[model samples]
Target: MTLAIERPVGVFGRKDLPDDWAHEQVTYFQDPETGLRAIVAIHDTTLGPALGGTRFYPYEDESVALTDVLRLSQGMTYKSAVAGLPLGGGKAVILGDPATMKTQALLEAYGRFVQTLGGRYITAGDVGTNSDDLDVIGRVTEHVVGRNVAAGGSGDSAPMTALGVFQAMRAGARAVWGVPSLAGRTVGVEGVGKVGYQLIDLLIADGASVVAGDVNSSALERVVHDFRGVRTTGSIIDLDVDIYAPCAMGAILTGGAVVDIRAKLICGAANNQLAHPAVERQLADRGITWVPDYVANGGGIIQVAGERESAAMDQVRARVEKIFDTTVEVLDTAKREGMLAGAAADTVAEARISSSRARRTSPCTR
Candidate 1:
């Protein structure tokens, strides 16, 4: 399922960004005619062209959008590196409410901006965007992925992402309880959105008790209706569960939240789960097995990346299931070095990036 994607020769070279920025490129585009305001941040391209999703949200201001894109793009860099993919990291954010401002023309305008990058950035869907939106963008540029399967691109990535999280949860269970099963454990899931919904489905099938909480009542109701005997809770983090799954937005594991979490293991689909890196040390001190967010949530990216290369669905599924191995390796590394899991993951990913950098700059190649 893992196919080689060759990086374009000389397409990117290491350079310090403006203001000593660590990112490779940051672009801000505005289309007055279509009422589009967007930011695209390409953090690294040592492995290949930067690939990530476009998130459409109504930010309070451009500054907030900039912060989100930078953090997310950087996270993508680490995610791809640790997943052993030959892709780099980048992300885009459209500054508008999807419900009110999402139009075909607006998306096309965004696509045109993406086209300007000329393949240095490849985009898909995130947050408010979906496969349908990617189809619209595809009409403008060839650099889009994760479109509808009927449209010759991979469909929704949520299910594959959930599968990866389930595998990670199994790995974490093994590390903590000496078994790789969630058969009799209780899991508290925060966020029953696309990824969370499918994750709950898997956990239920594995015979694990599930209690979920979501801000959207309809999403929670849909889970209740579709699955029998599933419980709904007011606060997922406060529950006395064996595992806590934050499948929603990022920074759910803040300092205060980590102190109150009753779960023995923390593994979920959310990115940037820790509000700060120091929180990982807190979780470690508390004896909670916190699987790094990027390590646990690499499934969606792997699925979409395979779709970009025309890999079959079966192959993609097999690749995603390997999250179990990656998680176990990371946990083992952390324990052996007496470091937090997140720090250990960062060490592993950074080593890969550094090695790639060395290869790219070697005079023997030139």
Candidate 2:
């Protein structure tokens, strides 16, 4: 149950990075009354602000929690830059079960930790954190997103997120199969959470048949009832479908899931889809096209970062449509270079970051 695993060398070792890119910092928060402990890791600020969601989970070890925060925050950096946002990356992790240890005090304490960083990092809701939990953090600082509508914030990112994933899925399908629409195609959605359910809805509306699964019986039932064309299954990943949308937790695509996957294209809103780089390679070897999670699932961040909500949503839709173009581009690049989709994604992201930096620092801009 150790959270620590083999990772890129400098990912956790921030000291090795150049000073300009090495603003990586970590804060520890503890509420003696509630016995709640959490860690917030801010990765970089090359763009503008550091933005990432806060996740609450029962992490087995401190290192595992730290690693998750680091990797996710860095991924946020790439995601924002690639999506043409002015934010960097940061993330927070509470090493406890959300269903059991979550409390207002814990969230407030975590928000205080965020306050300590001034305005360098902003927090939003992740897998284990919700809008209600974010409301607690909002009491401590304005550096929070995903606030409830009653609180003058966009509470649920599910619909926007699902739209982005659907756009990416469409792009992937068209690029790979030359089909411009999802109609009549079978899509397997793993996890019928807020995002997953909406994704299923969009797919079904577009004439795509969906088979869904979730650990929550109520959620599964709701999806099945609302979408008459939809079917339910015990295990989501094992479903035989043309496309597999993973809206659940990270690392689900690791190990046997990669090899056993029957889907032609893998795309979803799940962060860190591949358990490791090797799994990315395995997907490539299996000829499964993958839309990088950070790139495909960046609509939520883009929506929250911009000032104009409607404009942001429109841009999110447009950007997500480009995921198809990017996916096709990456696939072509990989086939020519004999590389994995993940590596190609990294190359593209890195180049975009570099180009953005150069454009910003150019003499003409000055």
Candidate 3:
């Protein structure tokens, strides 16, 4: 029982939060043999159902994990609402390096914890988790999404996320450069993982030259082999390109990276892109158009919340296209009102949340 788990309750003032937030269900799992710890945080269910992803990382403290789950869950709520999906927000964190600590027993333990929610929170892949990990979680709870293709799930959330990012990039490009196509534009992509690799492929397909970087040598090699106009680098942030796509972990655009970025548009599937609120303003001052992370990377959740798996591809593409429209609208409004892009997106999402809450509580609806 660390103070981090108790901190959210204190800040939200148990009585002031939504009924579901008061409970703030969190399940912890510890494997005696492997000495591994994991926690799942379910935030609210005011919308329809709780949906989020399981991320594995080596967090320095329990508080970090707690804060991540809380913020990510809340972001999911805003993301779902803005994306026009009928889902709530939740997140699971495994406190270890996935490369070494992930085991079948550990995944099963995590799955059982998800089961404790009794279908309230659905789990998917994030950060260190992948379709293979989702398959393991699927063993315990059917509430898992992004499973392997053979398992009847959309194993490729990266492409859908990349699609959304590309769409947002196009909107930003149109607004700033007044270009209808990404052709002849140089885009730098960070973290050539599943999502980044797929995004690079899409960008190259659309006639955009790509410069990418990742710690994974194999992924970088694959990028080199697949596309001819691709360049690989050691550092992600230093690449001088038109658009900087951060498909890796969150908070990469911090104090230094923001200053070093040569891109005109900042958009990617990475959640919580800004290390601090001031960074958004920094981006704005630099004339770097930013597509809010939650609004831009919401296609994965939209695809999962739907009922039919067969039509998930079409729905994801459509939602990604919608993300472009939303980004353009938000950017335009932000420019007109002298506000930041993140603030504009937040305003739109918060309005939706407030309206949805009112509708849910209305006497006629009740």
Q: Write the per-residue lDDT of candidate 1 for residues 1-366, one digit (tens) a residue.
A: 001112222223322112333788899999999899999999899989999999999987776677677778888999999999989999999999999999999999999999999999999888999999999999989999999988889999999999999999999999999999999999999999889999999999999999999988999899999989899976799789999999987878877887798899999998778776678778888989999889988899999999878999999999999999999999999999988788788888989989998988999877
Residue 150 error for model 2, in Å?
2.9
In model 3, pairs of residues that clash are none
Candidate 1 residues lying further than 4 Å off, grouped into runs, are 1-21
Ranking by lDDT: 1, 3, 2
Reference-based TM-score of each model = 0.93, 0.87, 0.89
> Which portions of model 3 show Cα errors greater than 4 Å?
1-23, 33-36, 307-312
Q: How badly does each model clash, as a count of residue pairs?
A: 0, 0, 0
Pick by TM-score: 1 or 2, better one: 1
Q: Estimate, for each residue in 9-36, the C-alpha lDDT of model 3 and write its tens digit.
A: 3324432233443435667778787656
10 residues in a row with least lDDT, candidate 3:
1-10
Clashing pairs in 1: none
Model 2, TM vs. native? 0.87
The global C-alpha lDDT for each of the candidates, from Candidate 1 onward, is 0.88, 0.77, 0.78
